[model samples]
Target: MEKERNITSMIAAGLLALAAVVGAPERALAADGAALLAANCLSCHSAQGGSISRVEGQRKTPEGWQMTITRMQEQHGAKVSAEDKRRLIKYLADTRGLAPAETAGWRYLLEHDNNRVETIDGRYRDMCARCHSGARFALQRRSEDEWKLLMHTHIGLNPTLEFHSLARDRQWFPLAVNEVAPALARDFALDARAWKAWQAAPRTALDGSWRIAGFLPGKGAFEGRMRASAAGEDRYELAIEGRYADGALLSGRGVATVYTGYEWRGSVDIDGVALRQVMAADARGERMHGRQHFADSRRMGGALSALREGAAPMVMAVMPAQLRRGETAELTVVGSGLAGAVSLGKGVRVLEVVSRSPDRVVVRARAEGRDGLNDVAVGSARGKGLLAVYGRVARVEVEPANAIARVGGPGDAQMQKVGVAYRAIGWAAGRDGKAGTADDLRLGYLPARWSIEAADEEAEKAHDADFVGHIGADGVFVPGDAGPNPARPKSLGNTGRVNVVATVEAAGATVEGRGKLDVAVPDFVQRALD
Candidate 1:
């Protein structure tokens, strides 16, 4: 516990130091949207014939647009005040943002999912994924001509792209211009009925109470509430409070700005820990979903969802999302208008109602029977993708089955090792009663005994586990000391691959989940987006 507090304090202190030196204004003046854009973009972009080139008939998420504007500033020498930049991006996104449906599959790019791998078809994968995430391609709207030009722009920017192994096999430029551009234009066109329909729909309201449910990596699952009241046009002040399943208090206050009537970006400070929310409100504003993470680290984050207080009786989330067979446990249900008798899902029965309210219910449940994806409910409100009940744990799976951990460089005085927080998930065999089958089901996060080992046969002869890192019982793996360890063979640095193992005991038997962790050197160059 003291070690954990020291780590937290170090991170907080580093952030406070950075915050103090950033030298940004205390507050920004309201920007004139029309003037800022025309003055900043029209010069090099050219508004000849009454339309600025590459600006019309295009739409993107706020981050997408923000990236574009940032590229302009960095590469094209475009200058705009930070405050004006925010206003311009806001204006562009509000008027030309992606509809909720358009951003469905590409949200990971914005949410900063570290383990996502692009699975595009061979051709486009060859053309795009070689350079950046495929999601960066999916999160935009453009005309066919603009997409074609985009191909040219890419080749112009990175002339050697055609020389890469993936592109060298074919006529890279022609294939990109002829096939990839047209295909993307079809799939992500600027003009869409969905965007039009969204424009015509009523905007979701912001002032109200919200039930919050999420898992904080290294902290476990939590349920909370937030009060959002309008602060100004398109802005809100948020008051947050909640607790982890283990009874740890989760409290915070933050401010948010709603973009495109649905995108919710908020900065929150919980007990001195800063977190940022990258979520989207439903069209009705009744529910919000996405990830929230540390302000300084993107990979260290977790999924979050919320429901408005006054909405219809709707089951949004259940803490301790999984139930174990033949065992009884306390379950907390959080949602809007949650009242009446509770159904703890298949194989589970409510032994007692500990408490009840319109937005929460506490119940003691007895779970039994075979594994199944269970449905939780509060009377008529049924929870989906929220609860699972399983007999004895058949298997355990650790997320990011493969990951990379970094040891701080010798120059890194603080030895800021890049740690990875892992959680063990229990699973059960499907109806086929077979492990590792396609139908096997997840039973959610579970307690486990964590350990490390050699990654594979070749690694068995290595001293990676001895010199690389140590993982705590809390599932956080902190890398070994920086610089050469004099005791190592030839004073080698701590760098190698190790297997992270989570052992879970079920029915007096142990099931282990293994993941590969590559301990490597730290990155010196960093950026906010990275």
Candidate 2:
């Protein structure tokens, strides 16, 4: 029993020692977290109400603390590392879990942390720094709605940010306006009084000359005469001249109302382009802050900040027209900001141009030439055999004539024409040397006259009867008297002469003779011989 009691005491002491060791770390961790919070977060936040008194009772979840730390790094230039961020979040979540009373303040600070501004100028700088300067923002006195619309318009045109990003940024915008606009309004109120004094005191001073030098975000710069007016405080008018990049000379007249401290609101019409803008000087009055709006389809409005500088006069001119061939006509080119010149075509030529104004010119092109043919060759010109005008030509027409021949007896002859239309006669031949065979059978043009002779091939050769003849209108040959009968007659002795054979061919068809002929000698010849 004594041994067992001793063992139990040792076990209890061991358990107590382990508990002390584990408890020591928790205490150390809490102490370490307190130290970190004192070193970093206390500067901007406090347990009691102070600079950021709204968040004094606020508690945050671990995630909320992480998000807050990231916002600080982005907006306020805080440099907390990943490990430190984790530790900081753990400490905040353990020490001050979210409480109902602190919810509104905590949410407001977290949402608006990026927009918090310690100074009026800082607010202006943050709001307009992306596209313009603080000076440009300061020159405008638009209401909150107008400011929101301007920002929305810019966000629409800029594709870099998404809708969600714009929505997030827009939530913080009101906070910025609240911080900076009050200061601007106070400054403008004082400027109005000074402007009134300047206008009342101004007299006997020559107006300053303003000559246009160039343009800025929202307004044009010029150097010419600026005359003070007695109608209102710091009221003035200016006549300025300058040149555009295209060599066109521009002249403008403007009226301005000055607010004290070098701030001015004005509208001007240069050439035909109208512009409105606001300008203000910094506290030191060394530079101007302004916003300009141009009368264009885009209705572009932006900020402008520049130092005062001397101006000079220059001139610019309109560019000539650039013409190019397009299909069957010429293309007339007109640039966005420039006027277009006149052009002419094949049947048209520019006669004259009447100029009513620099921007408005009337051009006249008269038709002077015949309609041009579709196909034109540079060195040589040819046309279709058939008549055609400005259109495609058709195939050539052909009417080939048929072939014809004649056949007849010794003293009389007949003719006939045959075979295919739109065709020519080719070759013709005859046979010889047998009783029933053809001889002296020369083929020729059916002559104006025809006569039959002996069937001797030699005789036909001597007569040279193979000549070409054209088909007559009646489609027949009218054989005249035979050219002096052949010297020898064809003899058949007792059988007497039987018949004369003739053949005709045309294209691919042939016609042959098949009739007989008979001759009777007079008895007077026999009596004369007796």
Give the number of the best model, judged by lDDT.
1
Cα lDDT, all candidates: 0.80, 0.35
For model 1, where is the 10-residue window of minimal lDDT?
23-32
Model 1 residue 147 CA deviation (Å) reads 2.5
lDDT of 1: 0.80
| TM-score quality measure for candidate 2 | 0.21
Question: What does candidate 1's lDDT look like per residue over 229-317, in tens digits?
Answer: 88765888999998898889988999998888899999999889999999988878888999998886667788899888777788888
Query: What RMSD value applies to candidate 1?
Result: 10.5
Work out the TM-score per prediction.
0.87, 0.21
Q: What tens-digit string does per-residue lDDT give for candidate 2 at 1-530?
A: 54344444444444554455665764455555555554455445443321123222333433455656776777677877776775666666544433222222232122111111223355455455543433334333334444445455555656443333323556444543464445544532322433334434422211243212233322222222223343333456756554433334667777764433244456777667776645544443334445545533112333333332222111111111111112122212111111333433344444565442222223433443432211211111111111111111111111111111222223421212111111111112222222223322222121011123333454344432222112233222222222233342442111112213233332234443422222222223222322
Residue pairs whose backbone atoms clash in candidate 1: none
In Å, residue 196's CA in model 1 sits off its true spot by 2.6
Candidate number of the best TM-score = 1
